[model samples]
Target: MTSPVPPADPHRLPVTFRPTRTRAVLIGIGVALVVVLTVMSLLLESFTTGDRVTFITTGLLGLGVLALLSRPKVVATEDGVTVTNLTTVRRLAWAQIVRVNLRSGDSWVHLDLSDGTSLPAMGIQTGIDRQRAIADARALRALVDAHGTVHSAD
Candidate 1:
């Protein structure tokens, strides 16, 4: 019998790494909202009937999921950083980024470009997303430091 070859080494560099936030917390929150709605229905039954509870619960869950998942996109490439919005994408050459404060506020990576505009990193606003995103941020910072010579940060 022929032996199978193992998969190529997973640590290969020059690959595009995407930062992602987990949906567990959001899902949990959705569940909690449903429970809260159910409880509220029992207490505030003057307006909502028994049938409305089901509809309200389902609607709330859907809205929660949608809101939680609707986030911005941040990408790093050999050239520079890219921030994406709901309908548009912004690309900043490493040179344009003056300072990147990977700390505080609205749960996002804060960016300060040379022109005096500040924006947050796209993903990992909460939960596991924070941990993973911080790690990736470190890596991206390192990569930028080593390669982005023309681009400086303070």
Candidate 2:
């Protein structure tokens, strides 16, 4: 008889990046706006189907933007890194990354690609806590150092 395969360990999965306070604020604001608008709409005695539709549509659009804020994140695995932004999610291997830059005046940590292009890691922003952002950037740099390919200074 064939031996049974063992289940993989759950703790060994890729470590997810820390959540941001800015994202929480965004979600809070969006939810608050939606609630206030919904309450107001219901209070209006002259509310019609068209008005309801408009209110719902506006709420959805606003909430969608807030949802995007919650969606962005950076995950670091042994294989590579995953960056999810507002409009896109990119998976990049260690070899594809050139550098990680987190500096003053920048809104977020940006990844320099080996292809001479750059991508912003919106998951790490400098809005809420500057110290925390710096720390996260350092941690990400450590990940890059551990798994990324090294290039010679030509």
Candidate 3:
């Protein structure tokens, strides 16, 4: 049997769930890459102006991609939940979310919607930190239970 879910923290409303370590690491790498490229472009005597610009531009592009990778987040509020993935953002009401799941071997939390669709909540990924992901998923599930309408079995 699974452990009981802890109560949702009411004071933590407007809470944001994200991969903390992954985001920090990605952002740190991005910043370091940009700085290194910029310094190289300025210090290299053999590089032409065009070459320097190209190097800086390439670094910036790489940073942009890393930024995108670190952008996933799930925000929960009294109104509803807002899921922001790599390239998409979706908002759903409490009633619209039927369940929140983070099963074993799953990479991230998946929200089962009343519309019969499942949305990948990349913000709570298990790969980087499994315990934290499970806690976050349980918290989200508690929130859904507290706020969402209860459906009767047919």
The TM-score-based order of candidates, best leading, equals: 3, 2, 1
User: Which TM-score value belongs to model 2?
Assistant: 0.82
TM-score for candidate 1, please give it: 0.53
lDDT, residue 33, candidate 1: 73
* Model with the higher lDDT, candidate 1 or 3: 3
Residues 47-136, candidate 2: write the lDDT tens digits. 997897688678878988887877778888878889998889899998888888887798888899999998999877777776676666
The top-ranked prediction according to TM-score is: 3
lDDT tens digits, residue span 49-94, model 1 = 7566675767586756655565456666667878764455688787
How accurate locally is residue 84 in candidate 3, as Cα lDDT from 0 to 100? 99
**Lowest lDDT block of 10, candidate 2:** 1-10
Alpha-carbon shift of residue 139 in model 2 (angstroms): 0.1
Kindly give the number of clashing pairs for every candidate.
1, 0, 0
**Candidate of highest lDDT:** 3
Give Cα-based local distance difference scores for all models.
Answer: 0.57, 0.75, 0.86
Clash-forming residue pairs, model 1: 109-121
